[model samples]
Target chain A: MRNIKLTIEYDGKRYLGWQRLGDSEKTIQGKIESVIEQMTNEKIEIIGSGRTDAGAHAKGQAANFKTNSEMARNEMLAFFNRYLPGDIVVKKVEEMPERFHARYNVKGKQYSYYVWNDPIPTAFERYHSFYFPQTLDMDKMTAACEKLIGKHDFAGFSALKKTKKSTTRTIDDISIEREGSMLHFTFVGDGFLHKMVRILMGTILEIGAGKLELIVIDEIFETKVRENAGETVPAHGLFLDEVYY
Target chain B: MRNIKLTIEYDGKRYLGWQRLGDSEKTIQGKIESVIEQMTNEKIEIIGSGRTDAGAHAKGQAANFKTNSEMARNEMLAFFNRYLPGDIVVKKVEEMPERFHARYNVKGKQYSYYVWNDPIPTAFERYHSFYFPQTLDMDKMTAACEKLIGKHDFAGFSALKKTKKSTTRTIDDISIEREGSMLHFTFVGDGFLHKMVRILMGTILEIGAGKLELIVIDEIFETKVRENAGETVPAHGLFLDEVYY
Candidate 1:
């Protein structure tokens, strides 16, 4: 068997999520697996680097699967794209060593969230950005982001319903930038917990709006209580940008 | 009474067309009129620069309406955008002279057609671009575009169902540019016939594919027969860019 690595891009607007769940075929993984099974005439189990919730897009999501067919990289890319729907695309496909696993061998992942801070709405960019019309304090938001750039127990930033045993994760880098009427927050980390990015964004936004003090972030980080965290932002603005291994 | 000149933008994928038809309530103009009627408690008729077919988009469409309401430009812009659906936006509102008209006072217009020439489909840009996997000869396409640059009767390149009394239109400029895997064809003209840009793109694509010779363009122009023209391309790839007066 040959190990194949696939780079995927999806609009995630109508999907339930990335993982396959039961008989419902509304998930991204289910859609990809169904197309692959139809092409290979066999049941293929694919592993993704991580799960992105509904309405969270991805530009360079990585996945791996074992296949007996010795198709070329370009051929596989073309084949998958031909069968996939308009909202999902296989950007690239590569043959890897049999030991290369997409989930376990990942070095880092990057995510970005977009906010449209303009008073007027944009017709084309409505789906890809969150509309926040209120004025925000950029300096406070930046200060809060700087404090989040190190290793910490991100328990407070995750959803209360998450069942992950360990809540500690290291955030390698975090930066915020503004361009005209759009603000972008980029985060690089080894791994992320459930709804971690959204919760962090929500916390920063609260600080920016003067609803919470910037120093409150440290208290929440130390407490590790879900109630101390801010609200979770919407999922449409979050994008799983890339995976590096 | 104040005459308002509104700059509009829409993702026309959901609308039947720009014009209101038989109380369908699904047209772009119908949506705008309903919102205006609700805001002012009076029925107002809005005139657009031209009609865009279903699935066609607009970036800077121009329209004008006469209203007695003493609303400022900024307030009108904000109010219209708030009432309109997320897919449509009134970018700007200006109080123009009563003599100003969107359609009759227009001097020229610009339209652009985007073609994705990559082998793989693009997930994010699916609605805005046409995917063409075949290799195109850019030199042939450019040469054919040059033939259409000067003022000429574009009757042969328009749709056969067009019922305009005059079939003669002057094309001020036509250009075809290729940036990586994206091909953009822009046309500036005094007026355009129905589906003129799509047909022009189809004819140029035929020349690029070597299916039709460059000299056939002149023959079709002289014949002025719609049957001699190339096939009408799809509507989703066309964008009404701007209207100038």
Candidate 2:
């Protein structure tokens, strides 16, 4: 069997998420697998690096699958692109070593969230960004980002509950900057729990809007309570930028 | 009657152009008039700077309408933004002098067109740009732009039928540059004839792709025949960037 790595990009507006569910055709994984099955005439399952929430987009979602079919990498990429919907594109395909796994071999991930910090929402960015009507203080938000870097248990910023798996993740860096009319937040970390990036964005935005204080980050980290954090922003604003190996 | 001006931004994917045609309500002008009538309880019509083609977007399309209602400018702006669909946004509302006219007062206009020049089309830019998989020579495209600057008879570049109106227009500038993976074309002119920018883009791209020679621009201008020009690009990639008065 040949181990192949696939880099995927998708507009996740119409799909459920990156994971497959029982008898549901709305998942991105299911859609890709179905297309691959048609090309190879074999049952195949692709392992994604991680799952993105519904309505969240991906610029570079990494996945890997082992296949018995003797097809060239270029041919497979073309076949997949031809069969997949316009919203999903297989960017690149390469043969990897037999030991490579998309899910278990991940070293880091980078995510970005866009907030349109303006009173009037832009028509072009309506689907790609979150429209926040209230004015946000960049100074406050910049200050709040200081508390997020480094290794810490970010259970309070996530939606996971009573999990036996460890919730401690090492956040390497966090950057907040304005991109034209939108505020862009980028995170580089080893891994993130469910809704962690969004929750962090919501809390940072609230702090910028003066609804929360700087000390709230410390409090949430200490308490490890999901309710202690701020709102979970809409999924459309989040993007899985890249999955590292 | 008090005259007020509005600056609008729209996605244009769902609109049937900017002009109101007969009884059709799919136009951007018709939509705004309907919303204004509902708010003021009086029928109103807006005169736009010009008509944008169907499926073409706008960043700052200007329009003006007269109303007897003494609604505050800020209130009117808020009302339009609230009632309008998410794809149509009213960015600014101001009380203009009674002599101000959207169409007649235009001193200049700016338009931009985007072309995705890459092998893999990005899923996000599918609707916003025209995807040309072939590589292009920027030097060739830039050379073609020089022939387009200044005043000339653009009859061959337009879609106008036999008419008494002057086919000559002064082009102040034309710029072609790369913006990330996309090629951006900008035109600043006294005014543009129907489908002039798109047709110019089509001709210029052909030159870049080596499909058509640069001397064809001269032949088209000298002969003033529409059939001598290259293909007219799609409307979705065109945008009315600004209308200067």
* iRMS, all models: 0.6, 0.7
lDDT per residue for candidate 2 within A122-207, as digits (tens), equals 88998889999898888988888888888899989999878889999999988987877888899999999999999999999999
Q: What is the TM-score of each predicted model, taking all chains together?
A: 0.92, 0.98
Q: What would the per-residue lDDT of candidate 2 be over residues B8-46, giving only the tens digit for each residue?
A: 999888988998988557889888999999889989878
What ranges in model 2 sit over 4 Å off? none
Error of 2 at B228 (Å): 1.5
Count of clashing pairs, candidate 2: 0
Query: Which 10 successive residues of model 2 chain B have the least lDDT summed?
Result: B21-30
Against the true structure, candidate 2 reaches a TM-score of 0.98
* Per-residue lDDT of candidate 1, residues A181-226 (tens digit): 8899999999898899999998999899888888778998887777
lDDT of candidate 1 at residue B160, scale 0 to 100: 51
True contacts kept of each: 0.84, 0.75
* Prediction RMSDs, each to the true structure: 2.5, 1.2
Instruction: Report, for every candidate in turn, its global Cα lDDT versus the true structure.
Output: 0.88, 0.92
